[model samples]
Target: MKSFFSNQFINKTSLILLSLFSFSLTSCLDKEGEAPEPTPVAYVTLYHGAPDAPEFDILVDNQRLNSQPFKYNNYSDYLRFSTGSRKFKFTPVNAANSYVDTTLTFKENKLYSVFAVNRLQDMEVLVVSDTVMTPAAGKAGMRIIHLSPDAPAVDVATTGTTGTSITTNLNFKEHTLFKDVATGNQTIQIKRTGTNEVLLTLSDVALTAGKSYSLLLRGFQTPPTGNTNILSGQVVTNY
Candidate 1:
């Protein structure tokens, strides 16, 4: 009877240990099958005009990314992105002679930059992207530049689904630049400072996520003639 009791106790202990081992193994297997979070990618792009135009210096978030001119035209000049947000500034060797500087923004998985020159009296910047469109966010990422031989006052206004206006006075022969715009559809209205007379108005503008745009406004006001303005091409996106 003593031997049988000992044997029974040993069997129960062995069964309990086996069950514990099985449970641990199952738990480890479940953990192995669990999905992991995806890693974020930085999407960086450069948007500049003059595809046929000469290549110039490029600075990303104040860091020199490219010193030489890009090899392709407008479409090919844009850079591909990977991940992270970046601030970019492109200045041509002869900015005064060149049409304009390259303006763009770098955001996670999305980056766009565009460069163009001023031909007419007006200049414009068009923001385009494939990401979602949020007006407030889009406008926060945009920037604009105004150059004039004679420093003339400038004013900015948004005319679209939302009408927002801003005005500023520019010094003579001064170049004005505005930055940090939100994402969405809007317009920029430029007028001479101290005067209600409209100097230039950019309409049907689209601001997109992960993208950047630049505009060059040249020419100053003359006795009767107002300031010369330039308008950017349309910014199209799936959003």
Candidate 2:
């Protein structure tokens, strides 16, 4: 009877050892099968600057990126994108064909701006680097992008005619590097380059200290009657 109890105790110990070994093997397999996390992402902001074009869905490498359609003068906040060479497509809402198909390279830890410019008949995507360093105390970084397809080259004045133009002769599809501006209610004037004639005025735009901004000129100088897309000035914040 003592020998029989000794055999039962040994069998129970062996079963427990086998169960633990099996659990250890399963854990090893699970760790080996797990996928590595994705890396090297960039931030991008998309804009639909094409006048007379319908709302569009932004795609990357055949995958839809935007949650909804974007129209003229509409833009998005910074969104995460995988870094590398990427094919960007701008397709109309509920349509399969793309109007602007282009490939752009994005580096990791950088910011980018993608714009759909020109009229629909000759539309294309233009990519701009948006990387910026934080400005010094009490200063804000500012820049201008010329997106008006039909408008001529223009000068941007942060202060009416008294001070130098913020930028000059900035034509279609062109953008200037960021310049520092004092934060306050700034009176912006868009004038014909080298001339005092003003084309548009953005009254008392408030620029906050320690921030960055892009002043964009978009739409047409002469828009179609009743069309909301007109020659305009906009300040986009880059935080």
Candidate 3:
């Protein structure tokens, strides 16, 4: 019999890429012609958060995962993958040398986001789970992550600190737990910690009922010549 991992893969041909809060169910058959036990599976997404890094190709267990070179600030839809010890490699597009080589276990039935973060010199993979309490009636869930490598500590708020705090003192690579908030449009500001100096402001941001989101603080505070984008906030739908 072909043991699991040797002949096991989601969606048969490969991974099942799901979007937002979604799931895909599939089964496999053993070499004996009988249905095998259900293999543990998980959902994962890849993100290129390294602004100054070259385009990369993602590989898992010696298999190429992305058809195109994953570019800077881009992210892939959640893909269903087999659970257990998995090796990941990120190499420059069409290049033989890998910039990142790491491994992480994916627990069964969990959601994950794998980020290639920081500048090229300090690039690394940062993985995080995507589970949160369900939003109550008329509310939405949200959280913020600080991913700008060269950025100073910051705070995110709708109004001045006090009771309007969404996140505080969030440093590079730091992420906040999901918090439920009232649904509607509101302004968001990324300010220097403990002060009113705003670095970036988002206007009329919408939070829909019964949904969740991840607010990413990415890019460079002082972008290099080749990369012109400055510090900004990106919203990723979690569910």
Candidate 4:
């Protein structure tokens, strides 16, 4: 009778221990089934000049983001970016005098604004894009302008073998325009009809097939003593 009681007790104890172990294993498996959450990212926007003041070029770091054909009263001249700390520089292409280069340390997911002094009309930048194409295929292009505070609208004409004529009119602001062009190395000359000034001359521009290029044109400034014209603008390429 004693042996039989001992055996039954041992069996019950073993079963209880096995059940507890199984419960622990099931709990662990349930915990392992869950997925981890993703980390958040930031967004940034950059604007040139004061919010109420007129500006020509909007850049995110060294990259030329937007140029205005006329003075936009709203948020049209802003560039957006993902969140993080970034360093930026803003240079006025068409200012009367060479302004000090401005730089900013930016935070992700935030908005910033910079300003230009001694404004000149028709400031812009050029960019190139990467869309694969054959040399014999068509081309892509972009246009830009700089508008002065009270200058008249300027007309643009493009003389190149690859792209169409850029006849867009720009007011007192910076404008970045885009278009499709032919593929090859090309020379482009931009002339202002009223002043008959060859505002810009770009030579040996490598325009690839199926790619987009941006051309930035800031305003022109006259010499201090004479009536001669001096060109001041910035150009950049983007893929």
Off by over 4 Å in 4: 1-137, 145-152, 160-163, 193-197, 223-229
Task: State model 1's lDDT.
Answer: 0.43
Better of 1 and 3 by TM-score: 3
Clashing pairs for model 3 are: none
lDDT of 2 by residue, 1-239 (tens): 01111344434533432344445556666476665443556777878889889888876777665555676777866665666787888988868898988889988889999889998989998889986868779878889999988899999877854343679999999999888776788888899998999999998899899998989899889876766688998898877
The sequence of per-residue lDDT tens digits that candidate 4 reaches over residues 129-183 is: 2232222246556455453343345555445543566655565455544556655
Stretches of model 2 off by over 4 angstroms after superposition: 1-38, 160-164, 224-226
lDDT of 3 by residue, 1-239 (tens): 01122234434325432211123322333356654445577888888899888888888876777666778777877777778778899998877689898988988899888899988987899998988568879878889988898889998876433225788899998888888766678678899999989999987678899999888999999998878768999887788
Candidate 1 scores a C-alpha RMSD against the true structure in Å of 21.5
Please rank every candidate by TM-score, starting with the best.
3, 2, 4, 1
Q: What's model 3's lDDT at 192?
A: 93
Q: What is the TM-score of each candidate against the true structure?
A: 0.35, 0.81, 0.84, 0.42
Q: Give the per-residue lDDT of model 1 (tens digit) for 33-61.
A: 66534333333334343322345555444
Error of 3 at 176 (Å): 0.7
The CA lDDT of each predicted structure is 0.43, 0.78, 0.78, 0.41
